[model samples]
Target: MTASVLRSFWIGGFEGADHVNGAGEPLDMAAATAHLELLNGDYLRAREHGLLTVRESIGWRLSEPAPHRHELARAVQVATAARRHGLQVVWTFMHYGTPPDVSLFDDGLVERFASFAAAAARALAPLHDEPPVYNLINEIGYVAWAASHTNLIHPYVGDPQGLGEHTEASGYDVKRRLVRAVLAGMDAVRAVDPRARFLHVEPLVHVVAPHERPDLADLAERIAGYQWQVWDLIAGRLEPQLGGHTGALDLVGVNHYHSGQWEAGTERRLRWHEGDPRRRPFGALLQAAWERYRRPLIVAETSHIGVGRARWLDEVASEVANARAAGIPVEGLCLYPLVDRHDWGDPAHWHHSGLWDVDHDTPLPRHRRLVPDYAAVLTQWQARLPGAPPLPIAPPVPEPLPESRANGVVPCTT
Candidate 1:
């Protein structure tokens, strides 16, 4: 039950972020995207497209709706569905949202999270024959930055709307607490099932000095350097009090997006399409992560909205291929939000960022129409990667759509 292996190089990620938004309303991306209701079809399509592995998450708020009490019916349902589809799962225990009573700054957060983790592990472990991968927390840096620094989620800054200045000190505090919670949760899960494998997922980004702000070069470098802090902490290279050690850093999961590269301290994003020399190659980022931790890497999350989706897939897939050729052990690339989602801040706004777009007119389990262009790009890349099953038929021809409609529906965030 402890064997470590991935059936294919490609993985699909269900958008399972169940967090309270800036407006103080709970948002469930999986339900918004209809992934839960359409679970069977989604998995069948993923396997059909050669995506044999998937990234999934348990809604902590739902699983542990109350303090010290646990209910994992949905968690078991997802595990059963994955097993039935013959897919391997990468389970995320905490995805930003937690029980309302649990506070990030509280001493009890660590213990509460550990208890919930052990409960979930016991409930789901028997479904799989091989060791199941578990990500204790998804995007630790982003969660900290949101909850403490800025306030995109809970622990709002000034007013209830969560609009206010960033707290530098609070940011560090939240990060450490989150790390400790992960360590504790890992130990608990291991106690329940020793075969469990852990994945440390963090955002991978590059920062550069704006041409006008040459004086801020060092600051920009420091910002870019922050990406490694969490991994270091997990490996006991930093903040040894958090109970971090080498074994805690199992599989390194990096979440990168089109907006991942940017000009430090400014609104300008370093253009990936344009020849922004400041922009680093995706392969280089992967190589750097591998060199730093020397662990098997996974592009845990990556996708672009609208018309940019196909091109983004092509670029990411190419970079992954190049990295593997250069001997970087990138186990897989997950096309996240496998289905398009409605924005958390604005539910009316939909980001056509997934391989399949949603039709609003349809009922619960809405219609999922595959984006022909994206499918074509995926098919091309799957043929190049080893272990990917060949598609039985060619992807449909893409329907031409205006770039404005495809990419400009709404400004990208997160």
Candidate 2:
């Protein structure tokens, strides 16, 4: 019997700015591109490797420094190149950067973003008829984590002792505005090509020990609210508490990472690890999500920093397969940063998470080391390709007992 196959690929590089570390050392694009070309080889490389999709983001800051004006030559060059190569593009409107002229907190940021989205959609619609899929913001929770807790980027100062109120408020506002921008962008693209799809990406957060911190339990509920609230507002299931125009998203994008678990009584000691049992597995997360929303799900980003990334990819691909076998509408999985790049604002070398190792002094694909794992994924799923026999499903687990007695023993006579 064969299993279902899910296509895997990646979104590569940030636009406008060259890949750089937290210390601001710029990577050599010429050298990096040459290296990437070898791994995926221009057009033939990616296509032959079986990647059905590619992800890219247009920089709002770079494209439109001022209101209503767009600098699209570079964007057009990239998008055109991707199309010529036969790769489907999922273009993100705002990955992290905002236009220098607009303040995200401002009352009018939503309107400004909508207008910008419209302009972007208008410019890109001619190249493709598939209504453009727009990722309103990448990892909304992580953005808040960086800005509010880690001080990794703008609005650097945050009140950590205050349960991240400032960060939460800021993140909520930015996300609300971003969704509005996406809807506006979709409308704009639809005017040119009416099939535009909107995608919203949020980080997956897991509470490791709910019993330890009562506050964290409350926080967990709030975080889930934050994650899905924007979509609900857009879909008209809930009222818009944040100040932004409302409309439901066409797809929900998930930017899951290895380090998503939150352990109570260990807040300060929380560290990113690969095989933590307390962490919610990606398969479980996706399954619960599919059952809840029943919409198409895409793994927007996943990559490992050290030599273990290959193993990480295997685990993730298997999870995707499992999800698909269980009847979940799993669309794609993206190994973010096709080649390793510098951490956005962290210059201390704190986060070296990428598929390729950047410490090589020259960028190159880690494929030689990673190919085996990639091949394992390919082989596992390829066997399940169309027309192949369906794979057998695993048996379900039994439910737990209802209650216990006072003698530290339950009345279990089964």
Candidate 3:
């Protein structure tokens, strides 16, 4: 069967994670960057670019601050806004943040997560008549890997020393836990809304063994497979005990960056630029995921750190074109953090990876000024997209919500 593509050819990504930064401090992009306070303006800005879809966070940390009891004021507002703006919402349930009272290693972790996921879906049901789209448990694999492999943040649970340095086993124990959490969350969403769709957002990568360690070529391939373990588990291809079925898995969203390529079993980072024989093209990496899952694929997250913003976007556009040529049904390319953000390790240092950059020293809703140079480049690149959908003369206005939903007792229907 042919893979599916999104209704809109491209989408925008809003940073909404409410997690702590590497320096052991909290980082709620929506709040820190005034996104929450100025959401209406943010939506207007994004819509102005002709984006009919956008990614947002449900703020698990905000809701369920305590066990059982839940607060969903913020989530309700976001869902309503998306409907008002007529934007297809792909909400992120867990953006690397859980309640302070909960533990990822707790015996009831899965059940606790399920309750929250179901609750979020129910709250939005009245707002969204179509099947809900979700990036359930956003980038869980990266969360576990970063915490365990580096001082980026404290490890989630067991193995404070990290499994990466251990020589005894596969070192994928962290990845396994992430997959389990995802399966549980997916089940929860389905229970509440059977028509729910998922986008398993994970980093796509490539690696090779060093010349001196030619014997490690096989080992390198195994390490590369680590990236596919979660998907494989969900598809029930690799681990049958995970309770995953073929139909449970949905679209695949890969977060790719210039530095995603690297040398396995070492600290070497591979270049992801043009004409580098060593550098693998983004299309090749995307094809690997598409071929394995046989599902629609999207470049869910992509951006450059500095002045290379324009060039980087141009390269990604080429990758999207190539993906289309390969019959991969590549749906969209999202520029994450459409607004520039602070560094995770050093909040003082800003990364100029966005089309718009705000002055941190300024006050809340710090006027998202456009980066003229990058904006011009983006315009040119967007126009050059091979299969880009033409912009509608007027944005669609969502249907007026029925009065029955005001009672808050509408039963969800397929």
Root-mean-square deviation per candidate: 11.2, 12.3, 7.4
Give, for candidate 3, the lowest lDDT window spanning 10 residues.
390-399
Q: Cα lDDT for residue 74, model 1?
A: 86
* Residue 205 lDDT (model 1): 87
Ranking by TM-score: 1, 3, 2
Q: TM-scores across all candidates? A: 0.89, 0.74, 0.86
On residues 1-414, what C-alpha lDDT tens digit does candidate 2 reach at each position? 112122233333322223222243443332343443442354344565566566667766666767778776655766677677766667776665666666554545555666677677777777764446667566555554454454344444444464432223336545555554544444445555555666667765555445556666655555445556555645535443321232344566776666555554444323445355556778888877666665667777776656566667777777877877777766667766554544444333423444333344343432322345544554565455322223333211212222331111222121
- In order of lDDT, best first, we have 1, 3, 2
Question: Residues 286-324, candidate 1, lDDT per residue (tens digit)?
Answer: 989988987878889999988999999998888888887
Best by TM-score: 1
Clash totals for all candidate models = 2, 7, 0
Better of 1 and 3 by TM-score: 1
**Model 3: per-residue Cα lDDT over 1-414, one tens digit each:** 112334355677887777665556766777777878777888888788766778888777777878877788888898788778777788898888778766554435666777788888888777776777788888866776654555455334335564443211332555555566666666666667766778888899777887677887787777777788777876768665555556656778899887777666674766654444667788889888878887777778988877788788888888888777767767777888788877765767777778788877765547788777767766776676646432222211222223432222222221
Q: What are the runs in model 1 whose C-alpha is more than 4 Å off?
A: 1-4, 158-170, 362-365, 387-414
| Cα lDDT over the full model 3 | 0.71
Alpha carbon lDDT of each predicted model: 0.79, 0.53, 0.71
Q: What's the lDDT for candidate 2?
A: 0.53
